[model samples]
Target: MEETINLKELFQILRKRLLMILAVTFTAVLASAIVSFYFITPIYQSSTQILVNQKKADNSIVQYNEVQTNVQLVNTYSIIIKSPAILDQVKKQLNLDMSVQELTNKINVASEKDSQVFSVTVQDAKPELAKDIANTTAAVFKEEVAKIMSVDNVSILSIAEVAKEQSPIKPQPMLNIAIAFVVGLMVSVGLAFLLEYLDNTIKREQDIEKILELPVLGVVTKMEEKKAAAAAVTKVREQTIGS
Candidate 1:
């Protein structure tokens, strides 16, 4: 015979194991909070924007063709900013101990769509270091691009500044705890169902009837030891008083 469960049984199962579920959920949330706050390193980001426009002669108005050319060159400049040529110079200028690859990993360059403006962002453990790296990278790239491509078009629009109050971009404690809470609830519920399924002990007459395909003829009532002893003493007292 096949067995089926209903909503009532599901609720009963959860009710029976509610304490275990809550314990697991609380444990997961606590572990996530601890790890997020203590173990992970915090990263700080600083960014500077640079404009790629052609250097025209004295008081010359910008032309549409020149704007289009600068827009197209933004992509090339973005890639060049992370290259060894620019990164090596940035490392030397900053007196950084990291290699070209390590420095490249810390820097990112991006441009606005269909625009000649691009930004260089740097991330480091120190907020001041991040600001310095961003500004220095833009300066070094601007100076080197002119020599490398023979185009004096790169200009710094803004330099990154150290923030008075900064926050890390990674290891969000609340988000991590929320995710762990969800995972813990799922695992705990799954384990509850698995334990219920594995338990084969008959708990009621209905269970016995279902398993054996037989009707229950009778059921023996259970009696507590104290109640049975009291009843026996009363019967003996009544017999002695009648005799």
Candidate 2:
């Protein structure tokens, strides 16, 4: 016969292995918490904003065409900001021990679509270092962009600053734990069903009859049940004798 599982069987399997499922899930959540809180190093973030606007030589108001041009240049400027030209100067000024390539990995230059305002973001293990890198990168980019492109358009709108209670941007413990909980639940439930499928030993009268292809004429009582019945009979006999 083609065998199929129903909702009741599914629930029964889950219920039978409920404690194992909970233990696994709890272990996963605990491991995630421990790793996130103690093992993983937190990454701190800092960012500085810069505005890309063209300067009019005649000292007049900026026009739409200039703004559009500046917006188009943001992509090119993003690359230049992380280039060796700007990073080299930043390293020298900051006296950083890391190489230019390593420093480039920590910096990111980004801007919104069709917008002239771009931001320089830096990430590091130290909050103060992150803030300093952000500000220094923006400063270097602003000064160097003029010399490289022969235009004085970039303006520093904001600089990065470290707060007293700065929080790390990476290794979120709660989120990690939540993901662990979901994965653990799925794995544990799957294991429970797998064990249920693997178990082929007879557990009931129906199993015996089904496997043997014969009718079950009688059922044998358990030893504990027989002992309990004999004890009850002996108690009744004692009571009758006393009467």
lDDT of 1: 0.91
Candidate 1 worst ten-residue window by lDDT: 1-10
Compose the digit string of candidate 1's lDDT tens values, residues 75-189: 9999999999988888888899998999989998888799999999998988999999999889889999999899999999999997677888887888999999999999999
Quote the positional error of residue 38 for candidate 1 in Å. Answer: 1.1
Name the runs in model 1 displaced over 4 angstroms.
1-5, 57-61, 221-243
Best-fitting candidate, scored by lDDT: 2
Question: What is the number of backbone collisions in each predicted candidate, taken in the order shown?
Answer: 0, 0
lDDT of 2 by residue, 1-243 (tens): 133457777898899999999999999999999999999999999999999887666868877887889899999999999999999999999999999999999988889999999999999999999999999889888988999999999999999999999989899999999999999999999999999999998888988888899999999776797899998999999999999
Sliding window of 10 residues with minimal summed lDDT for model 2: 1-10
Whole-model lDDT values for every prediction:
0.91, 0.92
Relative to the true structure, candidate 1 has a C-alpha RMSD (angstroms) of 3.6
Clashing pairs in 1: none
